[model samples]
Target: MFAVIRTGGKQYVVKPGDRIKVEKLEANVGDTIEISEVLLVNKEGEVKLGNPVVEGAKVVASVVDHAKGPKVIVFKKRAKKGYKRKKGHRQLITTIEIKEIL
Candidate 1:
């Protein structure tokens, strides 16, 4: 089965044994996290959706690792003004392995 869960203002569709990187969470490797903001779930082609979130539904996952995304560069310049600026950023993220859906 697969379920759609919301976290860090983003949604993810995940299934058992699937590993995905999500926004940073306050957990360490091997930590088990329960995500209760399940928006939808499909079991054997049987679909169920929630108005906002499905009550009594949750996705259990284990933290795999903490990671950082690729750096993104931002540059700004003004023509003939000799003004320029450059910046780079990397977003913190967490990798988790789906363990169960309940």
Candidate 2:
């Protein structure tokens, strides 16, 4: 079965044994996390879509690791005024392995 879930302001479609990287969460590696914001679920040939989220539907996953995304550079330049600015940022991320969708 597959499920569509929301976490940290983003939506992801995942299935059992799937590993996905999402925005940073509080749990540490090896911890089990329950995602209750399930938007849709497909089991066999049956599909269920929620009006936002499905009731009593959840996805169970385990935290596999924590890391950061690649750095993004931001550069701004002005015309003949000779003004320039540069910045770099990397977003914190967490990888989780989907165990089940219920």
Candidate 3:
């Protein structure tokens, strides 16, 4: 079975054994988290879509690690003007392994 879940203002399609990086979560590594914002679920050719979210549907996942995403450089400049700015940012992220869709 597969499920679409929302976390940290983002959505992700996941299945058992699949590992994905998502916005930072508060739990420590090896902690199991249940994502209840299930938007859709597919089971052996059967599909169920939710009106906002499916009732009683959830996804179980285990936190694998915590890391930072790649740096993004932001630069701005104006022609004939001495206005310039540069900034870099790295997003905090959590790596989790999907264990089941329930």
Candidate 4:
């Protein structure tokens, strides 16, 4: 089965055995987390969509590792004015493996 879950202000469609990277969560590596904000579920060829979220529906996943995404550089410049600013950022991320949709 596959499910759509929301976490950290984002939504993800996931299925068992699928690995995905999401915003960092307050849990250790290998910890199992249940995401209850399931928006939709598809089992076999049957699809069920929720009104925002489905009651009693959940997605289970295990944290595989903690990681940092690649750095993103932001540069700003003003024409004819020697004004420039540069910044870099790396997002904290968690890699999780989907285990089930319930």
- Candidate 2 lDDT (Cα, 0 to 1): 0.97
On lDDT, who's better, 1 or 3?
3
lDDT of 2 by residue, 23-92 (tens): 9999989999999999999999799999999999999999999999999999999999999999999999
Q: Poorest 10 consecutive residues of model 2 by lDDT?
A: 45-54
- Candidate 4: misplaced stretches above 4 Å? none
Highest TM-score, which number? 3
Cα lDDT of model 4 by residue, 69-93, tens digit: 9999999999999999999999999
Clashes of each: 0, 0, 0, 0
- C-alpha local distance difference test of each model: 0.95, 0.97, 0.96, 0.93
What would the C-alpha RMSD of candidate 3 be, to one decimal place? 0.6
Please state the error at residue 84 of candidate 3 in Å. 0.5
Off by over 4 Å in 2: none
How much does each candidate deviate from the true structure in C-alpha RMSD? Answer: 1.0, 0.7, 0.6, 0.9
- Candidate 1: clashing residue pairs, number: 0
Candidates 1 and 2 compared: the better one by lDDT is 2
Superposition error at 61 for model 1 (Å): 0.1
TM-score for candidate 4, residues paired by index: 0.95
